[model samples]
Target: MQTNSSAKKSKHILGLVIVDGVGYRNFLLSDFVNQSLNTFDEVVIFSGLPSESFEMQERANVSIVELPVFQESGKTWFWRKAKEVAHMQLHKYNFAGIDYNLQKNYPITKTKRALITKMIFRITSVFHSEKWINRFYRNQVSSFKKDEVTKVYSELLKREELDLLFFTHQRPPYLAPLDYAAKKLGIKTCSFLFSWDNLPSKGRMAAPFDSFLVWSDLMKKELHFFYPETKKQPVEVVGTPQFEPYVLDRYTSSKEDFYHKFELDPDLKTICYSCGDASTSKNDPFYIEVIAKLMEQNKLIEKVNFLVRTSPAEDGSRFKEVNKRFSFIKWNYPKWELTRKDHPEPWSQRVPLPEDLKDLRSFLKYCNLNINMCSTMSLDFMLFDKPVINPTFGTGENDLYDDQKYLRYSHYERVLESGAVAIVKNEEELVREINFSLKNPEARLKEQKELLELQIGKPLKGTSQRIAENLNEFSKA
Candidate 1:
């Protein structure tokens, strides 16, 4: 018992990861992990499936204990993992069963072929859609999977095992169970407010930790609204982790190559339309479709250039036809560990920075303006006090859960009203909004100043330190 207790006392800090979003989570999670390694005694990673995220994860830490199917010899652990998958799969496909029963109860199965086709499609979709695959992987290994892991750590504690623990998400699909179990076992635990889904509503912002670290108030407000039940926990709103790389890249940049690469006018304004993965993407008028059609019909306008951001999984499927007529920057999603291997020096610093990125910051930074469908980039542009255009496209006639409707941009409507954004409804309106933003630059700049006022005096740095500090407090509390 003394030895076990000594072991527990010896090293007890872990940065529990819920898998990095491919490379997206790299900078964000890495900052925490690297910093934790320096500050904490132990670091544990919780990740998704191997085929999807294994390579990227192990790059950070080889000790990653994957969720259910993500383990190295996953099949060997089937019995142990099966029940976990079963429970999680039930919750994910719960809606499917309910829908299926409703359909059959209505005798819709008289068309057996349709059912077969749908089943085939669902199966196909699981592999064909990276987004769907990601969702499946996340759900299957959910935050509860952490619960099982916590049990493992607790038993190991008897053998002198345990340490600090950190959680990655905020709600239903997350690995919160691991967090709860760890807290109960007296392990230090903390959660990174990685997305808008976990935000509390206006009233639910009870503090969930001795220190809750978040990117923006969007998270705080959302957490407050949904979990108002918890008394307000100590919270710190840090700037978006994604911005760290951008800022780092910016500090070392000449930002001039953009003009040479595009071979375009030196004086025109450029607006980057960053495409984010949102439920809205699949539904609406397919962004490129509307943009291309508008450009062809003569409304895309002059003096303003648009650059489309592409993801690793994006196969010109969304933009091939559009590219035939217009040009775009194949903006690679900036990855952390991979960046060193692939792009030794990021384009952000290369001599001629990408032109279409407005001049002020990233090409997405410009004196004229920047636009996005529902991307969080739009939020970043909001930082410049410039106009960001958001065009709303409904993903479904009826929202499965309105919150499920690309809740990534929670304060979206508020930002628009705050003069930080202009919400355009369709292609025609989008073209018009873009034209208006460029033609009236001064108006947009004024609004940019307005938004900056809100950012000032906010706790915007040292999220890692704050997180470490809070984890220490939570372990005691």
Candidate 2:
């Protein structure tokens, strides 16, 4: 428990980190904690809530502090409205940074009218210019004034000389004040790009960072393409720490035990249907139905057994209607239990439990093919050299089924472009892809290789170690 003697050559190089919620603890922190502990002389975790997942070693070098979860406070709401006015002005200038691809892609009269409306925003925005807005906010509000929530961050820094401030997730507005305080104090700051879809789908970062850690070159490019201002910031490709276990040997589970646990037939080729989030893809049961229908018709049903693995954020209530009819289909709900309050919070819901780690490894190992509507599990399954099938078709319902919507998602553009997986349009194509993948498992090997190199990046093993090494080098510098 004694502190490392070599850690104190100068003022302690403390790495102050912000862990957003329960989900980050399991999915992110667990993978990177040991490395952080070893790389920094001292590590202090500023967390939104208290959880067993954040509990680290009893070593004297590590400390944990709980803080209120960042919510949209009055000050933030005012800032957001002010920024909206600024955004209106920028859009009038035909801002290249705005995510207008969706409008550009779908060219209809309505969109044209919308574009014209955005032009009108310029008139309203003229009264509240960007320069005026900045000056007003700066003169009226302080980043760490008594009424500001960021005052606590100033107090925390006053107690210790922090060398570095790192945020695991960069989009939380709550951290904006802290980042501002850090900048005023001249502390170096960095953040990890949370996910593949983050840059395109998510909002602007809470604050500009000194550096950023990305999963691959794809993400770094996304930062440049979307937020051109970030092009000058240092971006280190650390790969993704979540997939580290996929590359490790210790987390592997025996196939016999895994199949038995799931009550799956070991002889039959297993196909895992990883569900998407409820808000986006509530009709997951429809996909489940398509699989069930194919199984009933005995097309590839005899050869493949389909398993349903709901999203960690889903409670399986949406699947109840389909679940009752297709009682024969096997189900695998996420083992990570959530409280009533935790269920609604995305970050809290994403926190993986110990069992999830084992379950994921086993599912990937036993399943010969993976099926999902653009789940990150595709990357995980690819790591196991398994074929991935993305079902883009829908059941016969206008509101219920729309295949075109999934295609427009910006993140999947790269995956589809790379041809990493088979995109099945209907049941016929689904069966065809499944049979082909099972018959010729190595057919997509070339595509997977391309994805690994361009999309995921190489040296898949030891990502956590690489991240630690980079952090240590930064500290030394």
Candidate 3:
């Protein structure tokens, strides 16, 4: 780590980069921006969102800059895809999720792109060393820096005179030029690992940084295991601000208010079913039907109010038929807007509304039990000491995408071992587990605490402050 002695004596400027809705929610919507402003002289946010849609409470010593659109050449695209395939080939044997994604994405197809990608995979598989992976990564980064976007970002950074560049998410391909520009201008850079499963299942990051911010020591170990090159860089475990809203008073609503707003019976216990995106959990409607039918038949131990919160990454139109059939199931569509309609990826363009934070917090606070395939909502509900039920009822061999395989992934193995949540494989097990959980919500309280501690190293109350302090310390190192 290089120490900036001048930064300690003079004003320090922090450049915060947010590329998507999740990042916007985690950093700008949280206390991270306020904490950073308190630590640094000025805080500039380089955002991928449109200026009109960048909704945040204005503050002094804070500004927002719209990032330029990155245009990728054919060579850069080829190198990027090749690097992803090569990385999966290198570690597919160790990570089941990576193996599944590799097999599912690049199968024996007849398309020209698939054929070319497979050929790249084969050639890279021969030289399956970390050295070769680094070579591929360098090729992609070098190719990306040649674009005009790099010059635009370089000029912006120069004008801002940034002491440190911080990235909220590390995997967006569009961020390569910004990262490269920061490094080119001799500015310190840092990135936060996006999610627990990102290191093992996702491919290589867009670029390397001087420091890394992770959620736990477990994630730090995983980073070293996957990318040994990061051993020399500082990896700080500051925890994530995603669950901080659960403890914040502003994001909470009274149970009566929540029930009345959602138009649900206050007498019945609430069971929330959080849906995955369209590609990850295509059979969510089937699962919804199973629970609704059980509720209709009076098969459960008690009558309960059912709520479904669809993924913010996708619209809820896919569940229109199911919603119509199960009129009893209350729907809580996430309040996320598509700010950038022309963006290549629709998921990246969706930004959550600030009001959704209160709604989500209320849902987590009041829900008696949460049901999903394999999601981080398990952690969120567990944060509130609520029971969670994960249903894996389909076979990968027969189904288009296997929800069961998620149970065997490297990141999820700890959840299974901790026994913090019930894993129900079939409808009978799901019914039995739901009944058991309702009867004994605190049965796995100890395990949930252990799992939460193991996954989230730092306390959740001051996560944003901790992260900001670490960034300031790293800047002055």
Candidate with best TM-score: 3
Candidate 1 regions off by >4 Å?
A: 1-8, 22-30, 49-163, 172-177, 200-211, 216-218, 249-252, 259-267, 283-286, 293-301, 311-316, 325-361, 366-368, 393-410, 446-461
Q: Which candidate has the highest lDDT of all? A: 3
In model 3, which regions exceed 4 Å deviation?
1-10, 107-109, 398-401
The TM-score that candidate 1 achieves is 0.63
TM-score of each: 0.63, 0.83, 0.96
**Total clashes, candidate 1?**
38
Please estimate how well model 2 matches the true structure, expressed as its whole-model Cα lDDT: 0.67
- The digit string of per-residue lDDT tens for model 1 on 1-477 reads 567566556665454655334323433333555565565666556554233344443553325555442221232222223322222233333233222322332324546645543453345333433243334444443433545554664454333344555555543222434444455666655566664333321111111343466666655664454334333575656544544433433333344556554443557666666665433354222665566556556675574455565533233355555566555432333222221213222321111112212232455443356656655666567664567777775544544213223333334444556676777665567888877877775566666665544432233345455555556556556
Residue 396 CA displacement from its true place in model 3, Å: 2.5
Which 10-residue window in model 3 sums to the lowest lDDT?
A: 1-10
Q: After superposition, how far is residue 241 of candidate 2 from its true place, in Å?
A: 0.5
**Each prediction's Cα RMSD?**
10.0, 5.5, 3.2
CA RMSD (A), model 3: 3.2
User: If both were scored by lDDT, which would come out higher, candidate 1 or candidate 2?
Assistant: 2
Which pairs of residues have clashing backbones in candidate 2? 23-351
Estimate the overall C-alpha local distance difference test score of candidate 1.
0.47
